[model samples]
Target: MEKDAGMVLHTLFEQTARRVPTLPALQWKADSLTYEELDRVADAVSGWLSRKGVGRGSFVGVLQERGLEMVVAILGSLKAGAAYLPLLPSWPTEQRLEILDEAGCCCLILQSAFRCESASFTGAKLELDDCRALARVEPPPAERAEVLPMDLAYLIYTSGSTGKPKGVMMHHGGTAANISRNAHLSCEEGTRCSFSNSYTFDVHVADIFKPLSVGGVVIVTRDIFRIPPVDTLSTLPSRVTRARVPRALKRIIFTGEPPTQASIVRIPSTTRVLNIFGATEFFDATLKIIDVHGCPSKLQSIGKPLGDYVPLWVMDPDSKELLQSGAVGELVVGGLQVSRGYIKRPELTSYKFFQAPWLASEKQEGGRVYRTGDLVRLCQDEEYEYLGRVEQQLKLNGHRIDCATVENKLTSIEGVSEAVVVLRDGDLERGQLVLVAYVSPSSAAVSVSSFRDGLPAHMVPTRVVGIDTWPRTSSGK
Candidate 1:
């Protein structure tokens, strides 16, 4: 616990770089960077950003594809004492502008390809070419900002109950705690980790930060074969079960969604399968190391809490009463991993996060707890069996889709009066999940093209069906 105190992400990377300056820090296709080189480049970015009046209490928007440049932008943002906000390239231009404006981004680090997309942005823009040129030049000596553990480390946007995206503010202390715990669990000096997740996803933090914190190598490439065999891989369950996994992969982590029995059985016996349960609001809260040959029932559980750093509780949704073992209730997470709540959303933050005096003795984030909105029952063994969500939220592929948000968008369509969104197994043989939208007024016409232009790819319903009338309960919903 003492070691976990006051730990920051960039400071940890600096420590590791000093210990292993010549070690490979990042590798993408034919290019690579040693720890010393990456540190210098990140410093250059920090200096450049400083010259542009970007520093502490600033938000740096990172809009670039996954590669060496992306990693540099992230580390450079941290080095500049600013939180990096990742904007997906696939998002609609309007959606990108909305987030950039909402976060009050002070600067944007982007590639030439996204210049037109971000032309409407009001913040100062630093292109990838600028970062490369800065790396080659000698950076001037500048005073580093005094960054604290509670300072914002990054901001990840997720679907909100309304038709907007909410930013989850993660601090350096919590991020470092999760990274240290994960690295201790699987990483060692010189271990190679595969970086496959999109930078927009929260899981990318574990994919990149976990390894770099422990003097390990991060293989940043879409093709696994392009780089040397990695020791560990973190990705969605669908990808690993459907595609051929690398034989040399020793450990595999599945998150975003639960892993099926068939998927777990597909992995080689030599590789360890760890199913992680968490959300964008928090890092990993619970983890289960799957025994591929064990009883299938074991795989149904989301395992125990991640040691004492994260505490899990079950409480009645209506009564707000704590439930004992074997009772089903909403899962509550409290610890250093709990984020600082949504950006500029006071009402939503107050509704989702609340104080818990009982947790004070545990020294958890001033006794703050986040309601996960997930229902689960505590097993006799202290593990948890995941029940369905308290709401209509769905996790398709690896992205979380809020049904209300999609429905809100649907209602905005000219002809749509009422709408409902759900997940269906469009291809049972391949175990693929598809989003379906059901709208009222059978005569109403809905076009998938319109949805494509208005919504993100994952949020677009694959099938839109018009119903004459909706079935109602006895009391009417």
Candidate 2:
């Protein structure tokens, strides 16, 4: 839409604000803000951040719960030409501090309600209340930086194999391309989309900006299950249930994990279920609109690439050679949706984000493509059937958990020499999967509760078992 080749995300929001200044932009509980109101407040935030020396190339840490304030902080950071890094309050204090330090954040926008000791951060700190107060007073005119499309827009930290979270550096151009494609394909004017995902999750970018970019409203709430009917709803497949499905829901997006045939049949035929397959490295790359009446085989496919902006290919995991149709191989994603690579991780970035020699003659964006570790097979009609990952990563409750990260944390515990983590069926009767950690030396007294402090709830193992010996195949001497 509108030649998004070099567009910036916030610029689209500003354009929509000017078009429909009185339209509702965001609503949370009893609080709400019109386009004009939200735009003006975001300008004030940008002014405040600008005064604090936060401009292009700067990183702003956002520490707030999901609500109106979080959206303001995000918009304000973008308007100030600085990338916003989401610092979840639920994370351990040390984890949050580590992320902020890694990103070299120049400013932190923290909500007064969220308590954490940020004395370690040698940067400007502005409370959300102060941001609100600034909106009440006329902000001084400050020269706005010329934020370019290639400028960094945000930093999202995903679980890493090195026992630390890695920040994904996303730029304005790629993010804008993703939001524009999704909005043009699914959203409409004045569409009301539910903001259900956490800000730390990359999908939240689509949930919030997708609607705002199209003069639509973002229904910001702590619980989407309790919200009124909205034009679009995005959530995990496990969260979908007959009782929780909103009435009059038009479209529901399922991602994070594959949806079962049983889960698809529960939705009303009138509603469209879009099973999106994507990663933090890139946004929504492929989308499959489930046909409730179709066969079970069709439901298993993660439909074709979203548009020309994101091109998909299947390649040999070892040789990195492109594979033909019907051959199962790693999924390679190329085009504008590809992120700017991981922050401060050039080795990993170069390995994962590389230019395909075959595509050198083609018109590819930046001549870069991301090697998604995910394995897949190209099916008929240009659809793809997911065949799991080549690495030991698991998706639980809509969040990707690196098994190596969990194992690393387990080994860090006292008395534990080595650790291995695996996803197993915890409840066979309910067909539920759970993470279980196995440590060497059966005598190692490791408590599962200890992991709760360091890892996210989803990444923590449900049980820890000590094993005296490692299991191996019969061929192993």
Candidate 3:
């Protein structure tokens, strides 16, 4: 293989294969596949896809839940020289079909047991158990084909909070580098990871793919995410000693809803809870590991960058100039691990990814940076303290409102909004936190005091406002 080709997925597979061939590569209930077994299965799946004309540059969808089948199908697609698109089982069947239609999937590798007749697709349908049977029937391959670093490895879709979900195109080199770096830091034998997030969330990229790629054990629990916060806290840690969470970056089991007594007792003494801070743009940046020893800092800071591939800068929000180390400004990311752009959304891509003005050298390759709509303060200790989202900081009755803080408060509010609220800053500090009109003012006649009664005092809004109309920009964001 060429030198550049050595940085992709198959290369990592070879390393894990050498280190622990008999080690458990994946485990779900009674089914467990070793590294050697997984490799052979990938080979057969690749051969099958190759026969079906799903090769390099082809798009394939893996629609399944968190199980041994999901792992095999993903590896099979990669081995077949096609990009894998993860179809989240938690999503409505129609939503999954929409993504399948948009991406133009050549084939959908799904589990026969979970297959719904309504899922629309023009591609060939392959079942997981049948594929496993095929894996046992086919002969082993001589060697896996090499893939380029810039080749598309997977197209991860964003949560469909805005109108419809969109896919983000990620290259193999960047994805491999991210997984490799995370594996070297987080995984080991008997280290069970609570693989909780849906595949669509980028959290899965690091949570599920990174650990398994390194031969670590992952517990794929199918529990619905909305089981009471206390119930989740109590039950989640029992399955895995360590878990990855999107919020609560600085502290674990504290922020969303305070863990109940039952929840606290469920935690293993050695369990390590990692509150990860990242976006789809950068896979995993800063992470704070909290365990029986207790967390070391306040509850909001996102820690620091992980591995050599990440570079962070705090800059003036308005000027786009790099701020002094201790100054508060916008957080900018420039790194090899960053995603290329949103698939088929050039106008949206241009809005987020931009030329780095702080970098004096114009010739620096990969110098283009992403302007994360976050406001942060650089501490003297060289850590980024997340102030709030720049997009959510709005003026409400002359007071600066951090939408994140409000949202956190609303998470505890009972029967107020449909539990879905978006804070729009008309201008800095002048914004409204709009509810989806599930609760009417005339019918409920709710007061600020009642809302504050449901949450911690700081989260209560200064003005309980209503809006009948909202103007949109050209992009409808």
Candidate 4:
């Protein structure tokens, strides 16, 4: 792999600026920012941030929906030599504040209308719209800004112990590496798109960054695209082709609540669907591109690693050893794709990232491999079939959830002492969960109805069953 990290990103942006400056880079409800417009806005924001004493090594928190503002904020952060932290609007203000504190964010950017709403960041907050309001102002001072390839580019806040949040620090080198390897996968020039996805989800990063990096235009819409539209279930294919999704534009990407058959049938014959599998720690690990006729287009398998930067492994889960050819095990990954560590959290990082002895035999040392927590069976053909996660984590309607996270909430119920939750397969259009709980007699007086009232709709198990005692392992004390 090349040592220079920012080369790919700088090159992509420069190419797009030169070729498609007037093409729509971002399109919202009524407002659209062409490549030239977006570039100017990003530069303006960069200049404004520089005047505010923000530059290389600075962390800037961005709180905005997926729209023109989000695009500008991300590119601006890159230009300003700082990492941009994206926070979801649905996130609780208290949780957002805690993340800001952990990241040591000096300046927070938000929409002007959002300022009227409640937020709890102790850092200096700047209105994104207001920055545009001051567009007429010129940059104050120009200073030399130097950014190391390994300098932190962004810090994403993920779930943590103590029910708080932990920040995952990403470096420019790693970010640029992933973008470089995947930009070619996006739609080419003149492609129109309905940019539908929550900005917080890591998968959306590919959707936003890659398209923009290329000369294609991304139509930014307020209405979330992942949610299935019942009205267009029968006609989605034609609409999709007109929308010009990425090369792999299968209707299945729009995972809805139950996964309706109508929605599945809507996949046009011309649409190409790509099944993506990976975690935040590992971006775009594997790709299985399916044809509109629903056949594997690439290698009849998830293709090989993207760049010279990644190494893959299949290990025996119970033995915690490398599985020979045709043996099934948990998939482990190591290489440039592996991030340095979580921000200010060494314990968690050590727990997930560990020494891979298999690398020793391969003559590759001095690297840590991430245990993906995935179970895969190596086929005789040398390809791997994904079995599923070894834990309670599952993708329901395209949302990641750990049964433990919800089970913990159930046990917190006044009457419940212990709880177990499982996903039930059915109604591919809507997802449902079953919750089994054990409660004390006195606590039993607290009705299941009342207990459910205290939980979020998603956490409230569809079926609630009361148990007399909780199951325990043989080694239980």
Candidate 5:
């Protein structure tokens, strides 16, 4: 790795902090934190980690909820020159421990309020009861450790088709690229950002960093599943008079699962919602500026790639040939946004991230791109409309089935809160392909019979399991 492959993720945070010391860097509930304060506090955190022997390249587990503690832990870990691994408090204890052990984390940062299986961790704990108090501390011995851009910034785990979770290594360089590429998403000084997603998912990266990258303040919402209405973006003093939203604070960005069509219209018309799409391999490569005034025809068609910095190519999955206009093929994301690869799984890493001569520009090196399993079409308007996952196309009992279509259609039913359809491999010798549907809020009136009526008979699930909730991955399911 080059000594300065790119700018370290926290360098920009420190730069902005120095320039605007008293500017509000974050907002949690009624309390607010200044840029200078956050930086000084993170310095203290880095020093604390140094005393505990954590430094560059070490993975530190952050088991705090989305609040002051969580934000501080992330910034502090970066300042300490360590990769911050976010462990969602809601995750099962066994899964958390497995990930903790897998990453070989130096220590776990937890809030006093979080009651996790601490005994199971059996590791160093930095439990802060009042994270805000640290902002007033005196400068420490090791304020911020030196780190290379290639060094890991955070580690995110994603569930694999093979029934195991795999860790993806996101470096400082990749993170910087992601933010810089999507600068159009209202990354200005004093922009209001919402950190809604769990830190466990990489989506949190944009929510937290996009605002901080531009000296804007992030409203650290405790709510995990939803972003607050635009009116609520104000601090105590600002909301008193609602003349108009400040020009700088006009944009809100989110990924993973998108909001419903009805929910999108409810947001303030002034707010420009940027729907960002990307694979875990890259933070966010495609960003679409959705005009809330003119609602989308359908909830999909997530616009284009982020400028020329990152290239989006639709390629034939089997032949790897670049598809022309309007062709539905596997989406390939390339450019500076691509992460280093999977943490320790070389085979899986090689399988996903490969050289893409098809997408190479004169300035590009080796033309690296990540093969996203998502099926999307290059539309007539020069945007991409997500169809469904390639995995949905399964041949069972001599009938071709598209489970992705069924799942998309099934979610539209009024009573169904959420649903998951998976094609299971059972007794493959007899060509037994079992499609299982898991519906949440078990009492949800949506039934197997409805799926059969709505979907092609062959595409219908063989069994339906009504669980209280679908087993959600850190990505908020």
Candidate 6:
């Protein structure tokens, strides 16, 4: 198989670094690193790793909190021709060990003072505090090792439906394609992004590398993504947020879940709110910008496919037949962004990634496709409306019910703040799945009986459990 003529990630970083040596590449609270300075530092990092026996195809584990040090570790690891496995300091020791063992990590990167509690891994350790010593060692050149575009750029582990975290391997080409597709992100043009999302999350993959790809700058704040939406907006500088005033931020890129009405109102109406939908297997499947600025896609829609790089297909889950517009089916994504596959899981990778049958009939092209397992429909305008997960569809009261419909209906009500519908043990005699809801302010003027005015009686929640907040993970599960 011939490799595509794609540029490696670190190679792209070098192009921008040379093009804009004086441009601010990264800015934290008080310190900012220019492109030249960052390149020098990354080179030093590469040399440090090289001396520690980290080379091409090596998986180096990174367990530092979000900071300038973490950035150095990532770029440096890539420059050294090794894939960086990012781990949060907050993750459980057991989980960290599992990832370490599963990926067969060759080394670990962390701050000098940082240490994982109850965690032990037999790998060479590199610390950020060694920058001074590394700088004195006459560091090796950035081009010393060859890391091809098809080589693994990073491995982001995400918890699957089975409640186990698995690493998703992303090659340089897929990541580079995403950055190139979103090249307009350059902070040089005054359009910048706040980098607060956890390094462990794939969303951070773009926030960290996209700017460097375009000689743009990214504001790095510690654990900014973990905080609430309101606080995250405050970290952006005036220059970045000046375009979209009254919101205190430039472009707010949100993923994982839809933003709540309460959160939306806080953002300035003019601020570009981009809703990104993606999985570990694919960097970005759809890019939907929600605003009244002549944007055609609805707020509920996931917008059109990202670019020519990634094509969309709504396929019948059972027959694998392609569906027409407005027909609900599984969302299949195929293109350069479709990943190589899951690491060390051939069965899962084969099941998830495959050549789509629709390619022969609809596209007239040949390529592997990742079955998203997300139920959606293509609108008349070619936009796709998200209908929740395929597993989200459950059987209740002998009706193939979609809980998303019920939850969406409830949230659509005027007074309700948020709503989550869960399945409980159904009635023994009726043999129907019971729907339980957990929402705040149960008496928020929502009539349980009147709520059923539009929804089927069976779709209504069998029980309403009031709560101040829903129990969720750090990712807002």
Question: Which one is best on TM-score?
Answer: 6
Please report, as a residue range, the 10-residue window in candidate 5 with the lowest summed lDDT: 234-243
lDDT of 2 by residue, 314-427 (tens): 999889899999997899998777899999999999999998987888765657899988878888777898755678767887888867557656655666655778888999
What shift in Å separates residue 463 of candidate 5 from its native position after superposition? 12
Please identify which of the two predictions, 1 or 6, would achieve the higher lDDT against the true structure. 1
Task: Using lDDT, rank the candidates from best to worst.
Answer: 1, 2, 6, 5, 3, 4
Best candidate, lDDT: 1
Candidate 4: RMSD to truth: 11.5
Please write out the lDDT profile of model 5 over residues 1-477, one tens digit for every residue: 222247777887887888888899988887778998788777777777888888887999988876777788888888888999988787788888889998899788887665457666766778865665654553454445888877889898988667688899988886776575454355678766667566766777777776787788888885523344322231211111112333343554546654333335445666666677766678676767667666444456767776666678899989999999888899988766688888789999988998886645645443877898888889988888887777767777788766656666665555554567777876689866688877655776776777566566778777777777344455545
Model 6 lDDT per residue over 1-477, tens place = 014337677776788889889988777676778888888888888887888888888999988865667788888899888999998777778888889889999888877666555237788887675444565764766458888877898998887788778789988887786776665632433235567666777777777677777766777865443332221232221112112334555566667765444345456665667777887788777877767344222556888877766778888988888888889999998877777888899999988888776565554224688899899999887888988889988886578888777777776565565777888876778765688877655666655785778877778887777665455544535
Clashing pairs in 6: none
Runs of candidate 3 exceeding 4 Å displacement: 1-6, 113-120, 139-143, 224-269, 291-297, 360-365, 405-477
Candidate 6 structure lDDT: 0.72
Error of 1 at 251 (Å): 0.4
Cα lDDT, all candidates? 0.81, 0.80, 0.61, 0.59, 0.71, 0.72
RMSD of each: 11.0, 11.0, 7.7, 11.5, 6.1, 4.5
| Residue-pair clash count for candidate 3 | 5
| Model 5 misplacement above 4 A | 1-5, 112-116, 119-124, 132-138, 224-252, 258-271, 291-298, 357-365, 407-471
List the candidate 2 regions with Cα displacement exceeding 4 Å. Answer: 130-132, 138-141, 160-163, 361-365, 392-477
Model 2, position 131, has a per-residue lDDT of: 43
Worst 10 residues of 6 by lDDT: 234-243
Report the Cα lDDT for candidate 1. 0.81
TM-score of 4: 0.71
| Model 6 CA deviation exceeding 4 Å by range | 1-5, 116-119, 130-138, 141-143, 185-190, 223-246, 292-297, 360-366, 426-433, 441-445
lDDT per residue (tens digit) for residues 151-245 in model 1 = 99999987744656889999998878778877766667898888877777788888888889999999896643344678988877645544677
**In model 2, what is the error at residue 262, expressed in angstroms?**
3.5
CA shift of 121, model 2, Å: 1.9
Q: For residues 117-233, could you state the per-residue lDDT of candidate 3 as single tens digits?
A: 534577887887654687877654445555777788889887433655768887777667766666645565544554555566565555556556676665555542422121112
